[model samples]
Target: MDHPHLPGPAARHAPPEHPEGTAHAATLASFDRGLRREARPDGPGCRVERTGRVVRQTGPRHAWNGILWSGLDATNADAVIADQIRHYDALGLDFEWKAYGHDGPADLPARLLAAGFTAEDEETLMVAEAATLPRRIDLPAGVRLVPVTDAAGVRLVTEVHERAFGTDSAHIGRQLFDRLASAPDDVAAVLAMAGDEPVSAARLELYPGTDFAGLWGGGTVASWRGRGLYRALVAYRAGIAASRGHRYVQVDAADTSRPILLRLGFTPLTTTTPYVHAPATVR
Candidate 1:
């Protein structure tokens, strides 16, 4: 999934504004409140917890665990950070602190670093009005989109993931499988297949009651890049989100996807970096 919380598509919200405009600011504020501060669990065995100024999730080891939102500054940033470290440490869980560009104190990333958290690559937080997106993109010949609904489908997605991103997708597989099993309406996964061989894959996460749905894990193998497979995947999931009543689709996009997303009507609101703290044993 794009985030650790449940995801969705749209609501009847105002049209998007320029990135630096007042309406855009309002959109970001709404996102922070609805998608972050008031986040919900993404799948079975996961729970969202709040501790004063922090909103976080604790889940099974195979699930995403992290601080979704926080209101901290010099006054209590360190103490709260320490508390979180101890909290997850006690559970023997490695966790992430998702720090956004607009997050407080001007030194939160540094604080996370000092506390032994390693920051991964930063991604642009982009959003688009779901109804404004194309519902379909003509696929290249021989490539077809398939909806993922079972363990077999999940395996195909993870297989495409491992090849496209060059990263192990065991965790992603577990999470997707669990979500597919227990919360089918909350997520939609799809694969681009070239005559039975998976080439591209992605998923949409629907957050009911919120105006935003999340687009996650769109990756295509190097050989398949530039064939518009990724764009097709985005359009595919946006169709699902819009049909499901979401007003917007959000994505944590890397460089490769950002340009395409921008061209496809997504506006960058901010950047987010995952600051991860591994369990002592792993550290």
Candidate 2:
């Protein structure tokens, strides 16, 4: 069995190369490739395209959250990006944006600061080799980890998720569980329990499309922290991934959990930030 982290069938539509770890030019080239899938609406000033759901800032001068790039058109360059920002602002999505240092024109980040955007904490892009990944961890405390497959179990995961992330995302849980239920036997969920109560929980996503399977939503209760539950869950997930023929595991991690991932043989390669924009204004 391959490790869960390996790229597999889950990625049939993905490009041959992910624009990560490449030098400036190569990286842009990689993004250019993905452009075929997600990029469009090229022009001066910013416009919301993709059925008006995505905000596209052209001419290379906009502040967007976490990795949104602006075109570096020499004419009206900075203003164009700023127009994109203001346009999004008009849409009421003026909270904050994150951009990777290596994306867009070389000076994009600096320009974003000049436009009132702030640089917050930076986290690592971690990837793990699942084949070498370890499993066989003992449950910490009284926590009993179980593989969830039923509707009730899925609801348990959703409950734990809402408490942990401060969002009413039951729809996401439903989607995950539905996929898991319909998902071939290779993909699975492992929920951690404590005395019949669902506290710490996580899920494993095995992509038959790529050599990579992702481990996501490892949430533990406050009291459960410092115990080995999270690590054990990760190990458990990794073992399942390994058994499913995956080799690489990737996660976009937050600051609080960076060190733990580092200790577990995950390597930080690059950072990706999510840029959020609302409807209206730019439309």
Predicted structure with the largest lDDT when compared to the true one: 1
Question: TM-score for all predictions?
Answer: 0.93, 0.62
- lDDT minimum window of 10 residues, candidate 1: 5-14
User: Alpha-carbon error at 251 in model 1, in Å?
Assistant: 0.3
TM-score of 1: 0.93
Model 1 per-residue lDDT tens digits across residues 117-165: 8877777789999999977688999988899999999999999889877
Q: Candidate 1 regions off by >4 Å? A: 1-20
What TM-score does candidate 2 get on C-alpha atoms?
Answer: 0.62
Model 1 / residue 7 / CA error / Å: 27
lDDT of each: 0.86, 0.58
